[model samples]
Target: MADLSLEQADIIGRVALERARAGNSQPLTVVVLDAGGHVKLARREDGSGIARFDIAHGKAWGALGMGISSRGLAARAAKMGTFFTALAAVTEGRMVPVPGGVLIRDGGNRIIGAVGISGDTSDVDEACAVAGIEAAGLAADIEER
Candidate 1:
């Protein structure tokens, strides 16, 4: 399994922030989590909400844990509301089914980590994450329905 490097995590965070700025998004919080669901890096822009970190972490962690983009999770949640609610309870609120969490894949298509961004609309946050992952020469997996 390929591991997520510190350099890659840094690049993802930096580029995501730049994308957010270029898109005129409200302040953002970005979190990168290794495949094992450990946080590799986290950043919060000025004016980001106080819960931004937690929200970002939850998004990444949820994606990592479920082996799918949070967008997919959101879709699943919509169809299985009771199950998703149980998931959130079991995770103690760590799971956030939303569009901003994306899986990071290596050249071989192996998932190495995940990136989560919170701030603007979920779609905008997801776009920034995809940009950052691509900038780092990695693939961003967003399981679109």
Candidate 2:
């Protein structure tokens, strides 16, 4: 398994910020997590809310923990609210089932990390994450079911 490098994580963060700015999105908070669900990089834009970091981290952490994009988790949560509630409690509220979390995969199609963004609509946050991952020459896995 390949590890996500600091350089790659930096690029992801930078490009994500750029994407958000280019799109005229509200200030954003971006969090990149290693496959092990550790924060590799986190960036909070100037006007982003204070809670954005936690929300972003939760998105990425949930994706890593569940082995799927947060969008998929959102769908699952809708279908199984009780289970998702339990999952949230089990994770100590670290799991956020939403569209902003995206899995990052290396060239060989192996997941190396995940990126999460907040401070905008879930769809917009997800687009920024995808843009950043692609900018870093990695595949962005978004489960939109």
Candidate 3:
């Protein structure tokens, strides 16, 4: 699979931030991860909470690590909280079952990375991630479960 470049990651971050601003949401934290589940870039808007970055990272990592959107994971968690909690422990608290993490796919439909957003409602956060991924000329896999 192809890797998401720094330039693309930067674009995603910028676009996500802009989307959050346009919606008048809370100061957001955006995190982008490469195909290997490594962080390529991360941004926390001014006035964002201190733990926002951690939540963003966890969402992205969870999506990439599980090969599914964080929203899907969240859905599963809702149905199986105990198992999902175990999953969280297994991931050393890296995986977050939330609605903001989405997969980024390249032109050939290969997963390139993931993006996670925080500081807004789950649906709004997810919209920001999708917008950023699309703005970067990539596909956003925001699975709804």
Predicted model with the maximum lDDT = 2
lDDT string for model 3 (22-129, tens) is 989999999999988898999999999999999999999999888999999998889999998899889899998989999999999999899989998999999999
Tell how far residue 40 is off in model 3, in angstroms.
0.5
In model 3, pairs of residues that clash are none
Provide the clashing-pair count of each candidate structure: 0, 0, 0
TM-score of each: 0.97, 0.97, 0.96
**Cα lDDT tens digits for candidate 1, 3-101:** 899999999999999999998999999999998899899999999999999988988889987999999999999999999999999999999999999
Q: Give model 2's TM-score versus the native structure.
A: 0.97
lDDT of each: 0.93, 0.95, 0.92
Model 3 TM: 0.96
Regions of candidate 3 where Cα sits further than 4 Å from its true position = none
Sort the predicted structures by lDDT, highest score first. Answer: 2, 1, 3
Error of 1 at 70 (Å): 0.4
Q: Against the hidden true structure, what lDDT does model 2 obtain?
A: 0.95
Q: What does candidate 2's lDDT look like per residue over 25-79, in tens digits?
A: 9999999999899989999999899999999999999999899999999999999
